[model samples]
Target chain A: MTFVNVGTLGTQPGQREAVVAILTRANPQLAQAGCLLYEVGTSEESPDTVFVTELWTSAEAHQESLQLPSVREAIAEAMPLLNGQMSGFQYQISGSPLRD
Target chain B: MTFVNVGTLGTQPGQREAVVAILTRANPQLAQAGCLLYEVGTSEESPDTVFVTELWTSAEAHQESLQLPSVREAIAEAMPLLNGQMSGFQYQISGSPLRD
Candidate 1:
């Protein structure tokens, strides 16, 4: 089943753009790891937060990606920029109008 | 520039599956209207809420889609199944490494 992860990363004042940069950086490894879609954006309503939406082949693909060296490095690079206020939710994709 | 919308719709008790059904029904009209991605999902963290993530060629495309008869009809069908709680955020694409 396809797994979806939607979440926000809260950054310290003025650190939002930096986090967005890190998360949005190109990494071919993501697709090889089963990522279908990986989007990083910033919302007008929440200037301090960066919004991310991801689609993976499976829940396991997402979990295993966390242990990847490059992913770990990216997380390390982004952690300090964060404010520790993160909120998100994950789900298995049941369907899509276009895909159906 | 790409436009992204990430949001959640809170459904009436036990109406989640129904709402999901409505949101995920096949709609080729969405693509003709410039929708790149339109995903409907449900999260374990918030059982009553349905998550939606969308990507559009432009913000204008998304706004215009609302005026579409099919889109309006879909909204009407979904409104009653909802519990009046909705939270979402929209953003204009800055950049993405994958897309870059």
Candidate 2:
């Protein structure tokens, strides 16, 4: 089963784009570590909220990626732009096109 | 551009599986109407919460899908299983492997 991460990041007013830039630049490095999909998006309903949807080979892989220096650096950069309000859930992918 | 729907559906007790079944059965019908991806998952952190992650060709395609008879029927069936605490966001895909 694939591990899925779906979360919301609340950013300061006008800072969502900057946070997204860091995440966007970090994707290639993340993909090399078993990230099948990593999507970052901005909500139409909430301008300051950013949504990150990810698919990884396993929970361990996701954890391992976080420990990578590049990922750590990216997180450090994004931290200041965040408003400290974050909500997310982890799941085992039960159904998806990739499975088919 | 792709429109993404990432939402949480809170089920009544063990009703999460039942809700997932309805959504799973409705997938093929949804795909026929331009749904690129429709993934349904149950959160590991919250057993009663179901996450629906979808990618549509456009917001219009997604809107048109809601009018389909089969889709309407499925929603009606799933409603009774819901706890009425639904939270979701509509996003414009900013970065994703699909775009690459």
Candidate 3:
């Protein structure tokens, strides 16, 4: 089953773009580390939040990713731009939405 | 630009699978209405919450989908299975995380 982690990082006022920039730039080692998808997004409705939807090979694969230097570096860069407010959900894919 | 709507649906006790069945079965009109993806998931961590990640051609297309008979019927059927609890984020995709 694929492991999905979807969440938001609340940014400091006017810092959402900077945070998003750092996020989208982080990918060199991700694919090698079992990342299947890492989609980044933002919204006009939620100016201070950056949304992410990720798919990983497994929950363990996702946890191990945090120790990679590239991920750690990216987190360091994005940390200061954030407000420490976060919310999300984790799920092991249950089924395909389309039967076909 | 893809319009993304991702959220969690709180299922009534032990009704998660029933709710998931209805969601995954809703595909006849979705693709024609501009749905790119409709991923349904459930988590062991949050047993009662069903997570969804959707990609639509536009927010308007997603809005219009609710008017479809398939969608309307699905919503009506799943309503009773839900606990009236929901949480999610709406965002416009910014960019691919891979800078290449």
Candidate 1: tens digits of C-alpha lDDT, residues B27-82: 99999999999888887778899988889999999999999998899999999999
TM-score of chain A of 2: 0.90
- Candidate lDDT scores, in order, read 0.88, 0.82, 0.87
Off by over 4 Å in 3: none
Q: Tell me the tens digit of each residue's lDDT in model 3 across A64-100.
A: 9999998999899899999999998888887655546
> How are the candidates ranked when ordered by TM-score, highest leading?
3, 1, 2
Predicted structure with the largest DockQ when compared to the true one: 1
Output the better candidate (1/2) by lDDT: 1
Residue lDDT tens for model 1, A19-53 = 88888888888888998998888768788998888
Better of 2 and 3 by TM-score: 3
- Candidate 3: RMSD to truth: 1.6
Worst 10 residues of 3 chain B by lDDT: B91-100
By lDDT, the best candidate is 1
Give chain B TM-scores in order: 0.96, 0.90, 0.94
**Using DockQ as the measure, what is the rank order of every candidate, best first?**
1, 3, 2
